[model samples]
Each structure stands twice: as structure tokens, then as C-alpha cells.
Target: MKTIAAVMAASAFLAACGSDEADDETTTPDATDETSEETSDDSTDESTGDTIDYPDLSGETIDVASDWSGAEQANFEAVLDYFEEQTGASVTYQSLGNNVATALGTQIEGGGAPDIALVPQPGLVDQLVDSGDIVPVTENVVAQVDANYAETWRDLSTYDGELYGVWFKAANKSTMWYNVGVYDDAGAEIPETWDDFMSTLQLVSDSGVPGLVVGADVGWPLTDWFENVYLRTAGADMYDQLAAHEIPWTDESVVEALEILGDLWGDETLVLPGGAQRSFPDSVTAAFTDPPEAGTVFEGDFVAGNIADQTDAVVGEDANFYPFPSINGSEPAVMGAGNVAIAFNDDEATMALMEYLASPDAANIWIELGGFTSPNQNADTSLYPDEVSLAIAEQLTSAETFRFDMSDLTPSAFGGTEGAGMWSILIDFYQNTDDVEGTAQALEDAAVAAYGE
Candidate 1:
């Protein structure tokens, strides 16, 4: 959680640039620690014999566990510190470093899992929910988030008809970022359609500036393209179909999306020299810094925070944002990385902490700390660190539709295979731009092999 400020900044500087389905029957088996007896549906209160024991903060101590570190950790501590002051509950904060899932399981078995824990990845949420490692949050907490955050977030947080966790910050992935100065100098118009966008890329490439620089090695940035294409061509339902294993990867839409991406990669103007080899974190540097820099790239809302330390480029004016253009003037679609808090024990202290974290005020605290776009629908936009972030907050506020990461919606095995397939398709496409049909077939074949026909 070092924030990888510089690393993310460099990647964010790239448009600048800019799930799921499935039935319980067809779902991947839950992979969390088998030791966990608690399921997401479990509602037993350990402190009350058999009843849910609400925490009476008079002299109780609650421990919280997470992977948050550096600024992220500090911000969370601040939130908890404030919570302690208000509730008179003494709290201990523990940072478990990187091995969170394993540690949480061990600690939980030992009766330790901290009172409240932050589960960052969605796949983990699914596993945790199934294993009873975490329980559904209370109705009040759900209500608080519903009132403040966007519906897309609520939908993502809710699984199998119950609210298992409440998200504090959600990363919006359907975004493109560009250098204001570069655009101003070239008089290039921001692209609004997929064709227009490609044309603009050609124009920028023709201008002899780095047209687009993406760190393909990161895998996630490359994912941004597939997500957008899936939305543009197949729409959400189809996208969901792919995620749920309902549609084979060789479907027409999947093939077309790969071809389009291949075209983008084939363009010499799109990538910086050696960009194909760069990691996603470092690609941003190639795009923004002097000499061999790019004019545009694609990324997510968190890109701003990642870039906050580099190049004095302010958020609103120096940096600006636009949604991933309509694939064909269709509704704007978005992919999100949502973070959640799960409740395992139904004890009072745990419930109170859960309630506090999901509260509108807590959501606002997260926005002010500057790493997320709160999922709480009512979070105050004014609290965002900068204009660009505030603008994103507004977009989240008005967003009519949103989807979680496609790879995250399925089992890790499926997501990993799909991600690897995407990279393979992109690398092949980049090398064979002229062979669109061949490349498309190859991509389709690869996807089918990965997920089966």
C-alpha cells in the first residue's frame, strides 16, 4: 500500500488513455481457508451466547486488520481514531502486510481476525462469502451506503441477494486522460466515438508525438480496452454472459473486440518506443515525462492519486478527464474496482465498526483522504482533493450504469486465463495489424481454448 504514487502517476499519465454471471451451481469452488466456519450468511452473535451481541462501547476494545499501509493506513487509522472518540471504544490497529487472506484466516481461527477487516479484492469477497468467513452487514449500514453511494457500487457489494460488505472507495475504470498542453498545442479534438477516437489517435501519431503509451505488462490497462469493447459491442448483458461462462470466448463480440484492439496496437503511432515491454506502472513515465513522451493514455479515477506527486500537473486544468467514448453512441459504460469491509463475528463492537465504515460520513472521510471515489451515494463531492476528482465524483453521482471488473466477477482461474488470453491477443495483434481476420480468429481460438467452446 505504498500508494506507488510515482508508479501509478506514470501509468495514469498514459489516455490519458485511458463481469459476472454465473450461478452457484456453475461457480468455482470457494477457496478460502477451510478453517473458517463463518459464512457470509451466518448471523450468530458470539458475545451473546446465541444472540447477536451489539457492542456496548463503554469499556470495550476492538481490533481491526487490513493491508493498508503508508497514507492508506494513516487515513484508516484516522477514521478509527475518530470512531473511538465518538463511541468510547478503545481500538487496536494491526497491519498484516501482504499475506492478508492467509493471516486473516489464521487469526480468525485463533479468535483474532480483528473486529473489522478490509477485504480488497472482489474474488476474495466471493470466497469469503461462501466460506462464511464473513457475514452480511446490517440493514442500517446498507441503508447508509445506499443513500450516499452510486447504485453500481451497491450492486457490486451485494451478492447472492444479501449485502455481505459495504464499499468505501470504488475505482472507476472507464476513463481517458490527456495532456492539456499537448492537446492545446495540436488542436486535436477529444474523440467521442470509437472511430473518432482511433482517428484522433492517428492524428496525434501523425503529429509525431507519442500517440498513446500504455504499460501492457501490467495486464490491467490492457484489460481496460477489452472491457470497453465488450460494452460497446455486446453491451452489459453480453459482457455478463462472457463473465458467467454463458458465452464462449469465441463469440462474435469477443472476436470483434480483439480485432479492434489489434488495430490500435498495430498503429506505430500508438506506443512509445519500448512501450510494449514496459510494466503498467512504468508506462506512465514514458507517456508524460520529457522526451519520448505520449500525449494520451487510458486509465481509472485512481490515476489522479497515483500521479499526485509527479509533474506539477494539477488535476482539473492541467489534467482533465472524459468517459471512454460510446462504442457507437450507446450508453456510457464503466468498469469499477470496488473495496469492501466484511463482518465475520456478529458481536456488538464488530457491528458498530461495520456501521461506521459504511456510514455516509465514513465515505466522505475516504474521499478526503484521496485514494477513492466513495461508493456511498451521498458522499460530499466538495471533499474530493481536486477538481478532476470532484468532476469524477459528479460522474459517479450521475452514473446510470456500472459493472465490476469482468475478470473479478468469475473464479480466479477463469479471470487469470481470460487476462492472459487478452495479453496474448494484444501482443499478437500488435505484431500483425494487417492480418485482422487472422488475428481475430487466433484470438477467438485462444479464448475458446482457455474457457472452452
Candidate 2:
């Protein structure tokens, strides 16, 4: 693995090379077809100045699997189209839906695993690595990652000190999407501190609009809310300790975070009419649709996509987001999730595709098409469709302290399973805000059972 210092030096060198390329482009005309043909055999194509010399994979066919559908599926297919155009390789994509783990496992067991799988959870990566079902990426891919990704992103794709995947898409979960018209009507300002956030909620409520709307129907959004608060108040060290079950959920830190959340969740006047019963999509639509139902909805950057697709709201105008408010004077912390492309086969075609996905060239394709964020630091932020999307992408790439969604790092039974563990406990807490102590105890019990502590 390359050290951070080595990565920094390489970045500077790449920047210098880019500057020189720009100068040459400004002074010289386009190369002749003959010149392009002559340099085609070289590692670096002089005609296009593309650094990676993709092999002619005319007869190769690679199969990829993921859980993406709808607009997300279309956006990723655009990326695959570019890879095929450049390398002459045919690609097949399979949408395994929400049960990707089960579907992929069945394929692997039946000896029919796809060439690449876009995994969404680190825990699943650990499973694949432990089972020896996936292979480490080539050195070419590693170089792209070191140059284009932050250390946290690189680490998320690594297991047992070996790199296994490339993070192609990222989600900034520490975003609070609000209706611009509603905020203006309520005379509400974006809050910076915890106390300010609470006051703003009250202010919005006093103006005849509910302060917040959350989708607690499936329980994952609630986990995101808890994660943002816990990450801010408890700090990163204790946050990690709690995620790994090293510290019991009954600790004072967990209780304090819950109590803070209760200040808003406990007050019915501050929440939308449905309270915790609202579905995720409904919550998003409610906040941004015409004649907005509430002041704000908290979720990931993907809320922008929902607003664009489901509602007629124009992003960056009718809808926008602020960072999840700072708490206890803590430094900015971003909670994020991403889909990592991991290879099951290390053939020439597969490795070539992996290298492409790691490059900014591939990331830029989907980024320009809207409703996507890339963690690749080398990607062009200016390509983002709007300022709000650009800001979210910048925060993801530039955050000094980034943590994956905590539930994503834990076992399925504890973190992901419906109506159990943290999900159930938080739902119960939402329904009965006075049971802060019981919520903490329930969480600890579930964590102990799930983690076998």
C-alpha cells in the first residue's frame, strides 16, 4: 500500500504533468491521423494524450452485478458504455435488487459469479475476502486509487491489508434537504449548532409549518439520523468503539446523543403529521413538492434525485441542503456510503475495466448526467449539474473526518434487519421519547446479541 506522503507527492507530479499538457495543447494543433496511428502502440497515446493504454478487448465479454435500478441504473450504464467504447469490450449488467448479498452468494455457490460486483457494504467485502471469492486488484488500479481517492475511501475497499475494490459512487448522508420556499416563508435560517437547530425547528413550527419530516417506515433513515448526532457529540473514537461493540450502547455518550435527538423527535409540534410513519419517498416528496408540507427532510444527497424525479421542484432553487448541524463545537464530520466495484475474476478484461472505473474519466461520465456523486478527488466538480450537487461532492472528497454509515459496518441482524436490533430500538424511541434509558438498554442488549459480546 502507498503511504499518504507518497500519494501526496504523486498528486503533485500529476498536477504538474496536467499543467504541461494544457500548455502543449494551447500551442499545438490537433495531431494528424498518421501521427495518431504511429503512437497507438505506445503506453501513452500521444494523439489523445490518454495515460492508460487500454488493450483491444474486442472479443471479451464481462458481466457486472449491482442493486441499482431506475435512474441510477441508467447513469451507471452510461459509464459502462464509455468503457466499452474505449476498450471494445462487451459488458452485461444484472440488477440483483435489494437482496444483492443473497443473489450474489447463490451465483458464487453455483459457480456462476459475475466478473465484477458493485458491493455496497464493507461487511460484505470482508465476507467476500474471507471466503477467498474475490481477488486483489492489479497495481495499475491501486495507483489510480492512491492518486484519485482519499485514504478513508481507499481503506473502505481494503480488507486484511489487501485492496479488493474501487469505490465508484458515494453518498453524503450528513445532508439536511429543505424547501427554499418554506424556509423563506418561515423566515428560517440554516442552523450551525445543535441549539440553533432546535431553535430553528421551533421557529418553523411557530410559523404554521412543521419543522421536520422523516421516513421511519423502513428504519434505515432513523439510523442515519442517530449516526449524524452520535458522530458529532461522541467524537470519532467513541463512535468507532460503539460501532464495533467495544463500548456498550448503554454508555453515557449514547444516552446523551439520544436525549439531544429527543429535543426535536420528542416534540410532536416539530414533526410532520405522520411523525415516524412516513415512507422514505413520501418524506422526500413532502418536503420539496409544491406547497411544501414541512420545513425540511434529512437524508443523503440522493434526496436531490428524488426531488427531481418525483416532484417538479427545481434543485438548487426550490430544494437545497445544508450540512447536518455541528454539535458540541466539533469539527466537521461527514457520514457517507458508497458502492465499491469488486472483481471476482482477475482476467485481462476484468482488470482493464477495474482500472477504468478507478479513473476520473469514468467517474466524470455519470457525474455530468446528474443524480450522482463521485469520491474521486480528480473528478471535475465543475461538471456537476448544480451548485448544491457540487457542494455535496466537494464535502465528500474534502472531509477530513469521514465515517461510513455505522449500521453498514455492523452485522445484518444488528444493523440491517427490519424490526430488530438498532432499527427497532430507535423506532421505539421515536414512538416514546421518554424511554431514553430503555432505548439505550435495548440497543446494548441487541448489540451484545448481534456481536456476541
Candidate 3:
């Protein structure tokens, strides 16, 4: 198997940026406007003059569970529909909302778990594996994953040296979305370093609008901001150590990253009126809406979807994104998040769905529909709806270094739980930016408890 870095390097050469003409002709699709019936008819194999003899699953039913809702839920159901079309299977999708981890755990314990689920956290994968309910993927699914995905994705989905899931969706979290009109009006160029980023924000603040708006109410967004800074400041070695609890959170490197965040978050004038209380979707829209409330919002590439759906702003024109600025003169790093498809049952219907998801053919269905990206190297990039989405896809495949979200990697008691663990600690830090040492110490204490270190 190739190293993840090498895999990404090799895949980068295969990707080309889409044309401006294609971008100009594209608009974000309304989730309600498209239906599963519309999507299942299009097949990648048929387009290339090839045919697949799918298993005859006429009477089989497969149930899938995930935390997605609204537009995301609709988009994924379209992919499921394509599987239903290929094989004569009836696939049912259930949205478990924000508490999917807990809910899925209960279902598995009581022997009522869905056939398969799209899990968002690797830590949860470990927990599920330990419960002895998760079935190792079939050999056919393994071959598809080996052929289509990067080693990093495969590694993340494996537990105890056995592959248990397939990564179906990916996120590039190292992005800062800005209002184009506000940036041009403030005469600010895209910042390349931490100092320059702050200067740009200051300039925007001087131009009568707040410099940034953060949706810190849920706290995971703050974790992303910290992870990007930490990856650049401390480097990947220490990042891996900290994530595994091999290093304390009170380490100086952690403190430095928090202090960098404090430079923007600590200030009252630099943030929108609600400060840390704003919702993530509202913050994304506020940055691009008319008479914008803030100059920029920082989050994952998925922010573009919210801007398109909630507000009427044009994605590549009225709203755009730049890479998160380098911190402490470190090399560029990409922080990402993804959903892994794990099976709870090894039934024939479950195996078929898993294999299809691992194939590029299944990925292209969602990619063409808009607001989706994939780690599958063979996934067609040209199917991306616009230049913004295309650029994000390129970033995911081409980065010199990439790491999954830190919070998602740690134990739920420390990272994944709501109103507790990393979420609550970061929220408290956002409200009290002066408590830098306290925040670091609090995180370290939580890690000790969660990791039993």
C-alpha cells in the first residue's frame, strides 16, 4: 500500500481544474427540485458504453442510517436510489440527526441497528468494533476500496488491522469563506500568514463591518479553527501525539495555537454582534447577505452549500474562499472530515450496498448533484457543479499534508459529546478568551479522564 502522502501526490497529477465556462453555466441546485427518481436514471457505466450485471436483489430491503438532515439527507438518498436502480433492492434511509452516535449505539445494543450506517467519527468505529456487532467488509468491498481510495482514508476506516468501513463523503475544513464585495471594498488581498490575516481582518473592521463571525454555539467549529492553527504551529508529529493523548493539551504548542485564535476571537469589535452565540448556518449566510454582518466566516467547504441554500448569494462570485493562512511560518496543511460507511450486518444485501459505495460509480451520483466531494481517487472531478466546488475537490486530493479533524478522532467523552468534553471547553474559552492557561489545563484534565491516561 502507498503512503497517504504518496497516494495524494499521485492522485493530484490526475486532477485538472474545471473550466470557467463550465462554472459560469452552473448554479447550485435546489434540494427540493431534484428527486431520487431523477438521479437513479443516470449511470456512469452506461455513459461509458459499459454494462454491469448487478445481483438480482428484487425482494431484498436495506436500511441505512446517518446524521444528515435537510439538504444533505436528500442528496445522500439520491445516491441510495442509484443503488436501488442497479440492483432490484429497496433501500430505506433514516436520519438520526445530531445524536446519531448515541442513538446508533442504543440500536446496536438492543439488536435493532440498521443494516449499514454512515459514521462520522473514527472513535465511534472503534467503539462499534469492540461491541462485536460491526462486520468486517467482504473481500469484494476491500478490492474496490483498495482501487479507488487513498491509503489515509482506508487507514482511518480500519480497526485492529481489519477494514470495517468505506469513506463515502469528505470535507476540507481548512477554508475561510469571505464576501467578495466586502473584500474588494476593503482593498484587502488574500492573506498568506497569520499576521497578514489579522491585518486583513482589521482592515475589514475599519470599513464599518465586523471582521469575522463564528458559529461557536455548538463548539466544533472552534475545534476546527484550533486544529488548523495547531497543525501549522506544532507540525503533524506533535499533532498525532496530542490526538493520541501521548502529549498533554497544556503543552506550549497548544497554548500558542489558542493564543493565535485569541487574537481574533478575543476582540469584541472584530466579531459580529452575537459573538460565539451565532448558529453555523446563520453565520455563513450573514457573511454573504446584502449589507453583510461580517466580512468572513471560517469553516469547512460545506459552508458553500449553506450559502447557496439559505441565501440567494452566488457561490463563486458573491462568496468565495481562500486557504486558511499559514501560522508560525509552517508549511501548508489541510484538516479534513469524512463519513465512513460501516455495516452492522454481513447479509448479502448489506455487502452489495457497501461494494457499490466503494466504487467511483456511486460517488459520481452525489458529486454531480452538487455540495459533495469524495476521497475515491477515481471519482470524476468534472462532475463537480462549479469552480468553487472543483477547487475544493482539488484541495482534498492535492495537499502535501492532510489530517482528519482532531475532535472526531478523540473519545466521545472528550471530543464528540455535546455540552461536555472538548465542545464545552472550547465554548467556555470562546466566552472567556483571557483564560488561555485555564483552557489548556481544562482540556488536559478532560483528556486524562477520557483516555484513562
Q: Rank candidates, TM-score, best first.
A: 3, 2, 1
TM-scores of the candidates in the order shown: 0.71, 0.83, 0.88
The whole-model C-alpha lDDT of candidate 2 against the native structure comes to: 0.77
The alpha-carbon lDDT assigned to residue 72 of candidate 1 equals 62
The top-ranked prediction according to lDDT is 3
Candidate 3 clash pair list: none
lDDT of 1 by residue, 172-191 (tens): 78888877767666677988
Q: State the lDDT of candidate 3 residue by residue for 229-254, as single tens digits.
A: 99999987787778878789999999
**Against the true structure, candidate 1 has what lDDT?**
0.61
RMSD of each: 12.0, 5.9, 4.8
Show model 1 residue runs off by greater than 4 Å: 1-123, 138-155, 159-162, 275-277, 290-292, 347-349, 369-371, 399-401, 416-453
Model 3 spans with C-alpha error above 4 angstroms: 1-52
Give the candidate order by descending lDDT: 3, 2, 1
Q: Residue 149 lDDT in model 1?
A: 46
lDDT of each: 0.61, 0.77, 0.78
